[model samples]
Target: MCGILLHHAGDDDLYHLKEQFLEFPEGSLSSKRCSDGSPIFNSIIPYISARGPNYSSLRVSKKYKTAWYSSVLSLRQPFTCQSIEIEERYVLQFNGELYNHEIVHNDTQYIVGLLKESAPSIPAIIKKLNGEFAYSIYDIQNGTFYFGRDTVGKRSLSYFLDENTGEFYLASVTGSQPNFIDCTAGIIYQYSTRSKKLNSDLSISSPYEIATTMDQQLTKLPNCIDGLFEHLNKAVHRRIVSIHPAHIENSPISILFSGGLDCSVIAALICKQLSNIKKEKKPILELLNVGFENPRTGMLPKDVPDRKLALSSSEILKNLYPDVTIKLVNIDVSYEEYLEYRPKVIDLMFPKQTEMDLSIAISFFFAAKGSGYTISKDGIKEKYQRKGIVLFSGLGADELYGGYHKFANKSPDDLAIELTRQINNIYDRNLNRDDKVIANNGVEVRYPFLDEEVIKFSTMEIPINYKVNKMILRKIASEKLNLATISDEPKRAIQFGAKSAKMTKDGNKHGTDILTS
Candidate 1:
């Protein structure tokens, strides 16, 4: 994940606001360092360097001052590829990834290339591509700028226009907290860039409104289970293989595991995909199980549901998959640690959705910090690859499938409606909050369940009953993958599994209040 900043000062002097743009929130500017270990503030363009520590590039015209910054974790290196100059008339600044990187390195390159060749409409060009991206293309010749994000809203992009100064500013994060972030001026405005015209409201759907698409033909299709499995497997494969240093045979892929059905199924699929890719060079899997210290007991394993469940599943996978090595990363956070990280988590989440802050923050904080170590041949040292830690999260299963307990007793019609609503509203539910929290450590979170194809099939093509309680998913795991032990495990919410929900009981309970103001 990289940071892209654009400041178009219509009348305000750009130099006067240098300190605000050049510094990161929470006084982290001092910690921002380049590849050479020098402070980012020392760079020629400090604001660009501050946002993107690994690499920074800038383009300035009389009307606009743009900065494209990329950290070491940049998926396709937008700093180099997308920052191309064409006749010194057009420039691109991009942040995020394109799944079709083999053909086009970044969104800007693809969009600009299309413009150069045929100059098609922006929406038409976006429809032809698949990936999560936020990019800005400047036409110096026209003195106009075009900036947008992916259709699915997988990446965070926000813009604030100071009507007083006639300056329009766009950033990965618009504000850190209430009454903070002078750029946003209190009102939160996010980029709702989409391919298909979908409503972009950040509202949670009611339980009855969330349901799978009521399609009768799904059950009639031959090899239905295999088809669904293939789609999910492909989703996992895409994310796993996309990691930089592409072929790090020994690198471990991390999974936020609760030993429940959803995560366990993902674990099995990853192992299967890795085995198919290379029988000899099997990838190590890290199951990160976070268990918080109980306030009542002040103990480590204080009856945390995830602890026992994760332990059992880890053992089962270790015994079942010979080629795959399973590493259980146990993250036990003390109450003090939780308290210290809570405010930071809230601030890091742009707009600071306070209602679900504790639960989401707690889960992601531990998940982001969890790491797997590779021991040296002599067994004297361990190594941590900060960039290569790819996180696999079972996020969309609850929305796509009827994994939520609330949906258990819903009628078929209600379930169908509920699934459709949840699927449509999934991006805003917790995706942005989850992304910001996880990306804090530069580790990218990939959700195979949220794959565009998988989502379409699960929500539109598949029947609603198949998703209720994830019955069909369990069947595939037990029958095809031989994971009956985990397939039978009940669904447990991440907050409950990690003891976060219980701890934050008295804290803000109204999520709507956070977004409204």
Candidate 2:
């Protein structure tokens, strides 16, 4: 949600080459001119100002000869605390949330407080954190830097290291860096003396025990439908109540709803949770569905099921939860608009994989860009004044619950093994792409299905037949939750469902040239 820049000034003339290292391209989104009309990228090494408008702070460490800069996008808490400093010997630049901080302490503290409790053993500290985060801490005493992220890799971290000059650049945003290397989650990088070398040590796995507990609970229950429904409900409740008390009031929650089973389930849960909260003014629910149209026909592409299901689902949700204000914001995108923003999307995305992945990123780009509300009656002209700061995504549900058609007709043994593999490796498959696209719009995305507890139950405890293409999920929603509208909604890939791929192909054929030069 925010931007952070960290650099190590180790006996090099960084000031002379600052422009070469910090030049912002013409179309980059993160780097911008400050209030004083000076670009933040031109700031002094290790002393760059914060990146976003939410909160900005700078800290200088004479002891370690380092400077830390953080632009905080307030997620669950405010910006009362500064950089993470332990005994004035270590300072951390952090960029994510700590979901389990409440149980650790009942104070207005952040991961810094939790970190102090688990100090002296970095691996132990990493294991204790049950949230999405990416951070770099400098050890003033040892003259070394440590970097880490969560197991799900929900936060992006990249670094540029020049061994010959002992120069280092690390940041949470990877705009257009030339030779930056991606940091893997669940591993702590311990940068030794600048001239020596860099090494890494594996961190501990997620401390999720919901799988064993869910199995035991299901044994006691009469049927599997009740068991899955109960566990999912608890998962949704935890995510909503986990936000800091200060952030809950007047902070609307946005759901990337396509009217499919995954998103419909999330929307229903949020509606139920919000209706029960004891607040004077209830928070509004914004359901965003991106609609793609044919450039020639000026209508939604044929075979796009999202439009029909999304409209019906919105109507049902509104009638079901009248107390909570539910607004359906439909973003109708044309091929011309798709081509116009295609390069910006691709450039911002960095295109790490194949064209198929890039198409998915394009679909997500429009979805994220369409997060805000509309001021005009047309509803296509988005206003920057978005009421929702926190967006919820049903990302992990597909991988965990076998929502893909490929998982159909598989034997019990094969299904379980494949499900386990997909759940474990999901961080690499889709988290980074989705995380970057969503964060580019200055919104923080929370995944209820990816919560440690939800992951454990859906992947390990759910029975094989129930897990086939989310059969158990549909049954519970239809029979128990009474969500028949979305119970049997077929899964549609975002790119195809939103017609993003078709738009790109049509634009290219008509000589529109979607990629920016």
Candidate 3:
């Protein structure tokens, strides 16, 4: 929903704290006022305004001299303001969608209400947490703060501490800061205003538990297509239904499509749901496909691997769902444009600076930018700047369903261990970087395959036979959904498919190379 920040002022002078980890992106101070009617920030950094382009604010507790900052994207109703405060005793700053449908109108309010009513323990709040989030709740009465991200770490949260004065810091993003750390998901830390040091972390279930739950659910039903289909269907439906009507006005539901198994599967479900669930009239759904113009390989932007795949898949979708208007928005980024955005992409992926990160970020940055074109049925092209606030990403399918082919050769035991590792590493390897890059474009990114239920059913539940090459998901696509070659296409990493890799004469640069520029 927004970008968030919290800082505990060690000294009365807030000016010195501003120049530390916060002095990177740009130096325009945010002008949004807090609920208490005070300026949100005296200074700011990053492309901070972009994350919460709809609303921005800073809430301060004069007694503690601590400040909480939240910038909202406002994709739902109730236009809930943040930092959300309740009973004048508790305050919250959250950045994520509560797709749980717990608070259909305003997720911010739902969470702030929980933080207000729940006990001091972290479990009290986590037991009900649903969907992706990075959150901080302050107990004004007790001088305590609780902060954590969802177990899958689907959102970004970074932290820093100044030991000399026992001051604490947190932010949605802190780019390449000397001491700031991207907080690990599934761990909650409590900070006391009196001690200023952090308390022992309240641990939650490990990501491995998700694997365990999937196994348990799958044991009873050998053929789990019906169950798997049910969960998958619900996952896509909740993501759409949760957005308020007013917020989704005229904004097409956009997909970060790759024309591969993952995105095509999601695209099918979304098309089905808009007709069955939303029932919105002749809704236009955009398939945002990104392709890069790499000169080294003689690859034209229009002919990039993913673009061809998208054109093929677009035809499949059009043939399948004639009721909905399916627009394939080809987001072609030129070499010049890539160079122009490289620096900003690097900054957005703060603390994660690698050629691989840059490539992936650039791919998503342009895709989400949606500044491309949509072709008419008559083959005429029309310029389209996607106002797609809700961007569906097919991110977690590979991690959850064994989409990587290498795991196919591993033994049963090794495969289980590998799957567990993939689940745990998603936070570091994908979610953080992807979330920052996608959100930087002023859009919210959602993972349908990562829905807690979807994870529970896919992990260990579907037969190991189907998991190889993600045959299980492929089966769902082919047998149940009746999709075409999309159901059988081999997996392709987005960077390679989009031609975002090996950008220059450093064409031989490995994907893992630490970015120097």
Candidate 4:
């Protein structure tokens, strides 16, 4: 949820650093000191101070002859000097939530305890975690730093490592630099179920479209439902742990609730957690439901009424948690408005532009960020610093649990394999958009359904019938959370229900877009 900048010896001088810092004043840098222990000089670019927000920090180390700078708007936890470790050969700063911290911490302690040893590879240690993240660890020992995005690339981590000068630069967004390479517009291929093959028609710059193919090998039969539920529960619990109670209590945390099964499940889980904690005053939980001002004629299906889905969702949420506040934002703007913002959204979501077709999915996140809610803890304000804010999203529910109608006709084994393909597609399509848009807004987003624990459980041997039309998920929700019967309700895409302003060739459609300059 914050910004970190690192620079090694390159073409830039002290003045260049000052100018760069001035551009992002909300950023800070490492510094150098004299032998007398007095503050010697600033290491961050000066442009950061003049134009960016007034929140920046600096640290200097004579031992390593290195400095670090940060312009942090903390969402997860407050930034403390003690949390940052500056050694003789390393400078490390991270902006992410370590979901398996408890396990990792325990394992680290156990290993260190047994061998009586200390390890300098924090990144290597961090790779053991099971959640979304992007971070860089500077190793002065090797004169090289290591930066990586999560396995799914949920949290964006982009770097500019100049092979010519051996200098490294990292940022959450591409526009952070004037000379950033235009890596967009590349041919991005994806495994298409509809075509039953890998296709290279998609682009990193385009919107994400949902496409599927029928698998004839799987049978349509009832399967084990309890196992899937067990996995989902574990996933929810892990995501909840990522939400530092201290952070939520200090600042507002917003949830994007479409009233769909995925979001609804998350909402119920959060409410349950809050009640279990027994905190007299709960953190401000803002339920955001975006709807179209006029969906009857302009965009929606002829049979569907305006705001029908949102209304149903809102009603259920109100009945479930009357104490929680719900806020609705109507994006009544025309398609023109959507088109106007398309470019900026595309750039933010697909900085590398390996494909142009992914822009559609990216636009949705831009619209959400424009509403001023950070989807993750890192997206929160500095004054409200804590571990991190956890934004719950229902990302992989539809694909894994067979929420889509496409699964109705397929056999159990075929459905499972099909679902696996869809889940894998997440990385190339929605996952990147979701992670980048939130990270660009300096927020973190957590997907309980996409949790590793849930994935492992759902993929195990089970009856395929239980997954048909999200049968397993609905049963769990109804029994465990006392949620309304979801089996009877039809599955609806959020973009369609929200009456998104984008237009397609088919009609005023949810995922339609016209190529533009």
Best by lDDT: 3
How well is each residue in 1-517 modelled by candidate 1, as lDDT tens digits? Answer: 4665566655545433232222223234432332221122123223233334443443344334433333324444343433555666666566665566454344445556776764455445545555555665566655555565554456555555544544555555543522223221111123222211122232111222333445455554346577788889888777755554343474677888888888998999888877666635666888877888756434464368898898788888888787887776667777788778777677667565654565666677676787434334365435443233567888878888888889999988888777777765555666656666676665667778877778767765667767779977888788778888888888877777777654544444453445322
Question: Each model's TM-score?
Answer: 0.78, 0.82, 0.91, 0.68
Which candidate has the highest TM-score of all? 3
Q: Give a tens-digit lDDT track for model 4, residues 1-517.
A: 3445544434323222221212123333322211112111232233222212334555544333334555444433333321144444445555445566454332212212322226644433544655655554554555555555444455544444445544344444443244433211122322221222333343322222222332234342223345565666666666655555566565555566666777777777776655455455754555544443332345532123324554566557657775554433222334555567556566555443422343334434533443522223354322212222346677888877788777789866677678767775666556655555554544557777766666655655544556678866777677766676533566876655555434444443333343445
Q: What is the lDDT of residue 507 in candidate 2?
A: 42
**lDDT (10s digit) by residue, model 2, range 1-517:** 4555666655554343222112222233323432211122233221223224465554544334344556656655444344556766667677666667355332225545645673466556667777667777676667788886677777777776768766676766555446777777677888865444777756657433213222323453346667667777877787777666556676778888788888888888888888898778866888877767755434673235676677789888888888898877666666777778766666555535445556677777667666444434363555544466677888888777788899898876777667767776666677766776677776777887887666766655665666668877788778766798679788898866766654533443422233433
Report the poorest 10 consecutive residues by lDDT, candidate 1: 180-189
Error of 2 at 161 (Å): 2.5
TM-score of 4: 0.68
- Give the clashing residue pairs of candidate 1, or none: 209-418, 210-418, 210-419, 211-418, 211-419, 211-420, 212-419
Candidate 1 wrongly placed segments (more than 4 Å): 15-53, 58-60, 63-72, 75-87, 101-120, 175-222, 244-247, 279-282, 296-302, 371-387, 504-517
Candidate 4 shows a clash count of: 66
lDDT of each: 0.60, 0.65, 0.78, 0.49
> Which regions in candidate 3 have their CA more than 4 angstroms from the true location?
15-46, 101-104, 118-122, 209-222, 278-280
Clashing pairs in 3: none
- Residue-by-residue lDDT tens digits, candidate 3, 401-478: 788878879766677778878988899899888888888888899899988888877875665555668867887898
Off by over 4 Å in 2: 15-52, 58-67, 101-108, 115-119, 206-224, 296-298, 301-304, 351-353, 371-385, 505-517
Error of 1 at 306 (Å): 1.0
Give RMSD to native, each candidate. 6.9, 5.7, 4.4, 10.3
